[model samples]
Target: MSRHIDLAVIGAGPAGARAALEAAHRGLSVTLLDEQPKPGGQVWRAKSAAILDAPPTPETEAGNRLRQSVQDSRVTHLGEARVWQIERAEDGWKLHVLRDGRSSPLRARALVIATGAREFVQPVPGWSTPGVLGLAGATALFKQDLALPGQRTIVSGTGPLVFFVAAEIRRLGGAVAAVITPNSRGDWLRVLPGMLQRPDLLARGVSWVADLMLAGVPIHWRHAVSAVDGGSAVEAVSFRKLGADWTPTGEARRMSADSLCLGNGLIPTVEAAQLAGVELEHCPELGGWVPRHGEDGTTGVPGLFLCGDGAGIRGAAAAEIHGRLAGLSAAQHLGADTRAERARLHPGYVRAARFGMAMTALSTPRAGLAQLTTEDTIVCRCESLTRAAIAAEIAGGANSTNAVKSGLRAGMGACGGKFCQTAVARMIAKAEGRAESDVPPPTARPPLRPVPVAALAGDFDYFDLPIPRPAPL
Candidate 1:
């Protein structure tokens, strides 16, 4: 008998974990599907025994709470499962899921998507160096295995995340070459007022800054990484200070570093959303193309809702509250009484989300970052397509990002464009002399996360499947 879930929450991140707990608390049988082997999302991904042998931080503690709730609650937590497709069923929805080289169907009355975000790595020369890792990858490596990408690394990017990662790397006993940020002092001052809106967040940033300072790590302000240098792995890096327009203002500074952590900001992972036939709009401030949803996480499609970074890049605080909102709203729609929950928490979620938007606006990358991409710089590292190749496609009458993808195969790689789509769109926008929004993101299709063809074509054993209970007891 196929297991039927009342509400299914995708992802195991802060949003998904909280959403599962909230729905379960409201007397709903929820099945939380996560791709990770463990419960914590990327931000709070569990540490190995060696790493966890040390004490935990508040974030870890919070993650433990959510993990415990999901573990202790009746929520059916399915790890290492990839939800490939969602289709309309007679009663509600049928999700095509692939796991352990087999496919199965999961029926659900309602679905909550909290798949979270992917890093928008700013492409630079030699970025494909062996030692280079995305900001999120760096964090995951540290959290999962206490693995530092390099001995001496340059943690450089456009936002506050770089600072946080740099501090964490140091705490993990990794050496830092420098922390490079493209934002000038003036730009930070502009957001200083908005940062104060959430004193807690502001204090966190202040503390990261202090830790760097105390550790004698140099922070290069108003600078952007120009290139990574190495024959195989990262050996050194070059960066230049930028002006208001993001143009290089001075000579490039070169330094030695074994590894480089790169990211401009986070992009919402919307493949699952797109597969659900959810409408998406390009909103740069919220991290590229995002699924259309309301304050209560209601998508245009009934019985489907979205929350967390998958909905937008509002950080962890906003993600938690939004997850709660989406959960309670979904529960209320399912005939559960959550008015008190929504009434009490909705306002705070909106308030915190506003501040997050403000921060995203302040850190929203400017057009000047594209200037670093020379003809030889590899834009689509997955396919080895250089900036010139994509530009040539543009010159050959490729009008949209999809057209470029078709003609140039920039996104036709194992990564499936997660790393190249934004960069490709920006480059196309520049070449066409149009706004980036003019080029829509490449359409996310079925088999969203790459799966082996055999997995999709194969079936699992029915005999081993557990018999369905009458209903949630």
Candidate 2:
């Protein structure tokens, strides 16, 4: 049996939750689905019960309010529900969901994809080592479990997340050995005016830096990790000064640490949207390829909408506006009168977007990052392929991302290209001297995530199975 709804929101982050709330307010039967047990996405993910009584930050406070509002609203939220596939149907969209070991079908008149963004970790030698994790993943540890990544940690990466994660380590009572990044003070200064446009956020960022300085943490600018060293776990990290393009240039320095929190930045998670048949374009400022849509979130697809980080790398505040506009646009698509509300939110969306874009551009990975890898560094962890192997494949006629994937099985791993796609594409682009966009992403296939065979098989019996006859021999 299939459950039907007026609107189906595919995530429960700030954007998706708000989207469901807005549509439900308009008398629409909206259903919001998220992989987490609670709404808030990553930025606002509810803290663990162990730390529930900890002093709340602005993010936690805002998250609590939003969670309460949804709890009291008319929206129906299905938590821990994984949507494995979405397909166009005669009447609307069909979603195959796996929840609690059961498979179910959900059909909705309209769909909103707020799947959000993923951290982009550039590959360095020994990046696949056990103790190496992304900055965002480290934050998740602090937020959800109140646990630290290591006793002494080396935080190295680009973007605002680098600062936030290092500050979080100190706040959580963990020791931060040092902070390293490719952006020098002068580089950040160039973007200060635009960042200042959001004075409140600027203040928050300053506070993080203040905390690190007060703790006497050394901040190394214009540097990046050259390699990680260990036999089984991270024993030490090697770093070096970087050129303007982020290529290593100076003598390497070694820092002993039990763990390394590293990440380049974030990119929009567009697999779901791509599978939904929305058009995509390469917009580096938006964090690589993003869906093509209007201001109101209407895509070329008739009833599909995209918002939040999934649409692009606009931060959470802008994501909320994006969600609201999408909700109103979706309501209107389903015959609700929402023009007034839509018009009201447009200006704010534009403002937030400008600030967010500036931040994204500042944090965008430099081309020199591509030079960080050695011939033997693992580029695709799943298949254990090296940079040399991938580059050789490129020279051997794999000009496109898909072609490389087909030849070497780089992205055919369990992660479904989540980790390796962008890095691989960069390798292809650099080798072929083509624009990054020229190497289009590999084609999106169905069953958007890996599914257990039993879940899909249901309770079918051998006698009832639709067995096929053998082909003519």
Index of the highest-lDDT prediction: 2
- Runs in model 1 lying further than 4 Å from the true structure: 459-473
lDDT of 2 by residue, 305-390 (tens): 98998888878889999999999999999999999999999999988887787778767878888888899999899999999999
lDDT minimum window of 10 residues, candidate 2: 188-197
Best model per TM-score: 2
Give the Cα lDDT of each candidate: 0.84, 0.89
Task: Enumerate residue pairs that collide in model 2.
Answer: none
* TM-score for each of the candidates: 0.94, 0.96
lDDT of 1 by residue, 1-473 (tens): 15688998899888888888899988899988889887889887877767777678776788888888788988888889988888888777888887777778899999899999998877788988899998889988877787888899999886788888898898889898899988776777777766776988889888998999998999998888999899988888999988887777778889999999988888899988887879888887798788999877888988888999999988788898898888888898788988887889988887788778766765587878888888898989888998888888888998887898889787888888988888888887888789877888888777677788777656555677899889976
